[model samples]
Target: MSTTTPAKVTVITHPLVQHKLTLMRKKESSTNSFRRLLGELSTLMAYEITRDMPLQDLEIETPMEKMTGKVIDGKKQVLVSILRAGNGFLDGMLNVIPGARIGHIGLYRDPETLQPVEYYFKMPSEMQERDIIVVDPMLATGNSAVAAVERLKQLQPRSIKFVCLLAAPEGVATMQKMHPDVPIFTAAIDRELNDHGYIMPGLGDAGDRIFGTK
Candidate 1:
């Protein structure tokens, strides 16, 4: 359930991300606020996720003269939502990368052993040549994230990254070990996980709050 190994676990903790995550954590917050907060946090995560994306120069004609314009290089970035909660993050990621291709990897965790088993998976047209960024709101047990990434690996994506609203230490460690190649970007890493695999002092179910299905 943990890894003492040093891994690339990034804590966003940006003011905007923090402020929204706080509001989403409150018991009184409404569904609208929860959805808004998730979008805000997801935007911040998207920024970090694409920080080092390769870029190329393109010829462009300006009002004055022809010049070079920046284009997303062959990085071929694609957004893949992990389903349900992952859609929350996808909403914001799309805002930033308008033309980016989209993908979906749906997995539901088994309540008994807390393992992620894929029920459905549909990725972008060409995943092997692209770098996939998988989105999910909560990383409590890390089972879902790891399993999703494991499935993604079979697609032969050049690289992968994980984006989440919040995470527990146990989950972060587990994911890092399971997929050392995939860097994690999250709004916060909470203290611990509770008995039922929920983040400690963490916001209740993100899916319920965002969709108001509770």
Candidate 2:
């Protein structure tokens, strides 16, 4: 007999997430609407990703009496945006955890190789003590996510989680294979990537849709 552990992928089927995602996917959705929805959706997804974050009790005085309240413990968290599209996720996540440190990694795919090439990289100091969450709107080919994680690993953060609005099966598999320890949280997983490495039925180029650019 053989046993196997399932891949660490979380598909957020929450009704709100599903509904907003549908709106964003429509070809007729306006840029303002699409960008607004992404912000809202990112907040919902952020809630799920940090569900297990550690907390410590603090003694506080209520209006009527003293009480013990729970607050997130340890070092402030870090949100690493994978550039361009990833910025969409950052705004909403900051609303949820305003104190979190921000980092950015910019990589563009080489058309011929379909591999990620880093163009910019910056991160907060003391990453070793912080919980890091990497955000990108789409995980289509997985090249960028894998490469981003590979680079983040060098910093040795306390933990790393990847969050996206949509993911293709190939992308999920690639991340799991390359960095199995990093969990993935997404609103949905579409069928597969098309020949050009775009997720079928995806919301199109997220960076373009969000910014109303070609």
Candidate 3:
């Protein structure tokens, strides 16, 4: 196995993930449909990414006899939502990993500066010992996602993986160069970024649909 951290991102292109992603990508998709699809897509992708989590065997008493059971080992995994958009992905992930601890970091871009600014932050205590999965729906500019990871590092989590709904290659490249130690998992990696820095053919803003607010 490679000792180095994975810099590459695995786009969860499974049929179900792809179908839902396609629906969300359409300009004709309504807010309710987009929001519902995003949640479902997150659950599908999260399952694949979390498949290899270490498990420990435990002996259990059954009605007929004693049996062996497997349970996740080590500390509970931490799922951090990078604000409004991230919350969309976080909801589905939480459904799958109901017992996993959750964290939230709210970052928004400033109008004139076009810089990511943190509006709120909270993370599990003793996070250094747990696996961390930071989530956001869109990685358009990568500013907020990068900033969120930078902040998480200050707490020194054992390991971190970023999960997003869609990513532009530019954003992926930026994150790869800035924090090569972090691996990214996204549902789709779009072709390019427009001059305005939005992912080309990207779905409308994830936050708006998820919360039904502008």
Candidate 4:
């Protein structure tokens, strides 16, 4: 196991992200309210995560003038959602980068072993030329995040960034061990995970709350 510290974890401290996360954490927050807050929060987080995207100068004509302006370079970016809950982040991110290609990785954690089990996965082609962003709402045990990244690494994307609404220290450590090169972006890093592997002080089961399945 790698002993390197997780230096790539980015905790989003934007006031809006922090405020919206607070609302989502409330146990009494309604499903609609929670989902709405999550969408808004995801948009904010997306902005932060894409801060370093490459830009290129392009000559364009404006209403009355032609000027060189900067535009995102290269092909449309890719957003891979670790399915079910990861879908919650899609709308907000797509709203920002409407042309981004969408990918899905379906996996569930086995209760007995607390390990991720993959069920489905599909990604856009030409991954080597495009950066990929993997979105999931929670990184509790990091099993799913690690598994998803491991699978994506096989495709050899130009880059990979992991985004989550919440994360735990244990999860961050696990990800650092497995894929330290992949940075982690999240709104908050909550307290430790409980025995059942739920992040304490987290917004409960994210998939359950997002879909009101609980």
Point out the worst 10-residue segment of candidate 4 by lDDT.
1-10
List model 2 lDDT by residue over 91-168, tens digit each: 898878888999999999999999999999999898889999999999998999999999999998888999999999
Superior candidate under lDDT, 2 versus 3: 2
Model 3 per-residue lDDT at 164 = 87
Per-residue lDDT value at 39 in model 2 = 94
TM-score of each: 0.93, 0.95, 0.92, 0.95
Lowest summed lDDT across 10 adjacent residues in model 1 is found at 1-10
**Cα-based lDDT for every prediction:** 0.83, 0.90, 0.83, 0.91
C-alpha positional error of residue 186 in candidate 2 after TM-score superposition, expressed in Å: 0.4
Candidate 4 per-residue lDDT, tens place, 10-112, comes to 9999999999999999999999999999999999888889999988899999999999999884355999999899999999988777779999999999998
Candidate 1 vs candidate 2, lDDT winner: 2
Q: Indicate the worst ten consecutive residues by lDDT in candidate 3.
A: 1-10
The RMSD of every model to the true structure, in order and in angstroms, is: 3.0, 2.8, 2.2, 2.2
Model 3, 62-83: lDDT tens digits are: 8999999998743469999988
Q: What is the overall TM-score of model 3 with all chains considered together?
A: 0.92
lDDT by residue for model 1 over 31-127, one digit each (tens)?
Answer: 9988887887787767877888888889999899999989884338788888888888877887777767778888887888888878888877777
Q: What residue runs in model 2 are displaced by over 4 Å at the alpha carbon?
A: 1-7, 73-75
Question: Which stretches of candidate 3 lie above 4 Å from their native place?
Answer: 1-6, 73-75
